[model samples]
Target: PWLPLEDDRVRRLVEARGPKEWPKLAVAFNETLDEKDQRTSKHIRDRWTNHLDPNVNRDPFTVAEIEIIRGAQRRMPNEWTKIAALLPGRTDTQVTNFWTNTIKKLARRALK
Candidate 1:
């Protein structure tokens, strides 16, 4: 459920009121998209903080990036922001989801 935070309407609302108004903005944005409002303020804030930057590209992780994430997981556990910082160009949500869905599944399979 990715929001295009860069959308003009969404961006304007966010710029006008900041992250605190995300719930209202989400509804408005969803309405414009003709989509249901399934996102919460936290979801909007996370996208705004991590993925909304025009300079950042959303690319899949490389093997090296995965290894870095593994090491960071051992050191920082569930500290997603710290783990994301270790992997340049990645976001906390991306790192966290990767760990939860990919790494954890691999670990579980290996344990069997």
Candidate 2:
């Protein structure tokens, strides 16, 4: 995780140079930070793509999305990444967390 300042810098860098330049951006970005706080290019890229990108939708999941997730889980079972691919602007972590925190709890209650 990054401090707000670091995250701001990353967003600025991506806006200026775009996401494809992550390796080069990571090198430049890391030079401004202490060694203990350095992040890999892939890590930075994943963070930007999955969480920090302006395009990510942070809205509550819709009913259709919930049904899609339920269906996807029935077919894929634990395939969070694959399920996430079916929903635009969503990440594997988000999908897994929703299932673990919400849908799974509901299913367990139904069985009881």
Candidate 3:
């Protein structure tokens, strides 16, 4: 059974404190809901992160920045952390997704 987490109780638990409180909150969620649908600390933390304003945490990559990411990726393929380090303000997931979604798609289109 899918337990929807958009309820007021879940929202209260998420907004109650910072990341440090996620583990405790996850436990609380288990107690409040069902033990079978247990939410991990990471799940709680991700929910908090997802709720944050995207503009505050992420920005669109400039052309020069994309070039930098491409160059770094060629040098160290699949090394997301290294690629992210080369591009300041970008997370590993951002870099990897850009490579997979944007860059790779561009390449495929060019080849076709």
Candidate 4:
């Protein structure tokens, strides 16, 4: 689902399905947006943030990064495929890639 910028096929899929699938796309897009909103809201509500990483960068990962991992383990919602479908701008593949890459990165950092 990771639509690379170079990929024209997704554009075609969008063009072909966009108008017809507007409502469903909007639902998916909104779900993704909702998760994003949750990410922001959680950041505001979470007071124990520094308990994990005092110097956590205020990037997309800072809070969401950790929560995603925790969510994966806790299985509060659905599997990552469902989560991937709901991430704001990231495609399923992108989410998979983020998990694949960042999880390793965090693990490596933790080992030290």
Candidate 5:
């Protein structure tokens, strides 16, 4: 389920130049792959930023983090990215998923 062999190189490139060069980096990466395995720039960037970036926190959310997320969501409804900005180590996808899957469900149950 993981293709981590090229992750180190991807991380180095992104760290050196940032995500702005992701398209060019993707092209270069595709050049080294077989045609059947070629990936789109968006796919490459999303994979690195969302899953492979070392800065991303895979740990369980703490109580404080959940409170922060709740407060931020109330201020900026579906704006996951803005909410995520207030919580270090959390990606927008992670924030959105946690809110939709955990927090919202708990709230619904509490109200019932």
Candidate 6:
């Protein structure tokens, strides 16, 4: 019998597989993030914060995820260091990780 991979098990496999496999597993992760809380979708709420809901993007993150990240940062214009100061439970280093990645991804898009 072909037992489809269990949810947590499949995601764990994906994590070990790395972002190179993100496209293949993105939907699963998004669904898990949605149902994880079973109240409202974390992915949806995050998209709201990222301004990419259906009222916004009509889909979850995509190759367009980078664009959505770029747009949200523009709407803030913070140093991210500053953003960390304003946010609870998140460090500047964390924000900086994303900030740097955002810039690199945007640069790649611009190069195309």
Best by the TM-score measure:
5
Off by over 4 Å in 3: 1-25, 28-31, 36-38, 49-56
Q: How many angstroms is residue 56 displaced in model 1 relative to the true structure, after the best TM-score fit?
A: 3.5
lDDT of 4 by residue, 35-111 (tens): 54322223211221222223333335446655765676367433666775444544444455567787799899999
lDDT of 3 at 93: 72
- Sorting all predicted structures by lDDT, with the top scorer first, yields 2, 5, 1, 3, 6, 4
Question: Which candidate's lDDT is highest?
Answer: 2
lDDT of 6: 0.47
After superposition, the stretches of candidate 1 with alpha carbons farther than 4 Å from their true spots are 1-6, 13-43, 49-51, 107-112
List TM-score per model, in order.
0.58, 0.77, 0.58, 0.37, 0.81, 0.31
Q: What is residue 16's positional error in candidate 1, in angstroms?
A: 7.8
| lDDT per residue (tens digit) for residues 1-112 in model 6 | 2123444444364456642443445454456545543322333233223432122223323454445445656777756655655544444445566678767998999999
Question: Which scores better on TM-score, 1 or 4?
Answer: 1
- Tens-digit lDDT string for candidate 2 (16-105): 898897899999889977998998998889889777988777788899999999999999899999999999988888888888989678
> Model 4 Cα displacement at 89 (Å)?
3.0
> So what's the TM-score on candidate 2?
0.77
What would you estimate as the lDDT of candidate 1? 0.72
Q: Write the number of the candidate with greater TM-score, choosing between 1 and 5.
A: 5
Distance from true location, Cα of 44 in model 4, Å: 39
Instruction: State which candidate, 4 or 6, has the greater TM-score.
Output: 4
Pull out the clashing pairs in model 5: none
Stretches of candidate 6 off by over 4 Å are: 1-78
- Give the higher-lDDT candidate: 3 or 5: 5
lDDT of 5 by residue, 16-86 (tens): 77877778988877887899887778877888878888889989899999999888888899899999999
Scored against the true structure, residue 50 in model 5 reaches a CA lDDT of 85
Q: Alpha-carbon error at 52 in model 5, in Å?
A: 1.5
**Model 4 whole-model lDDT (C-alpha atoms):** 0.44
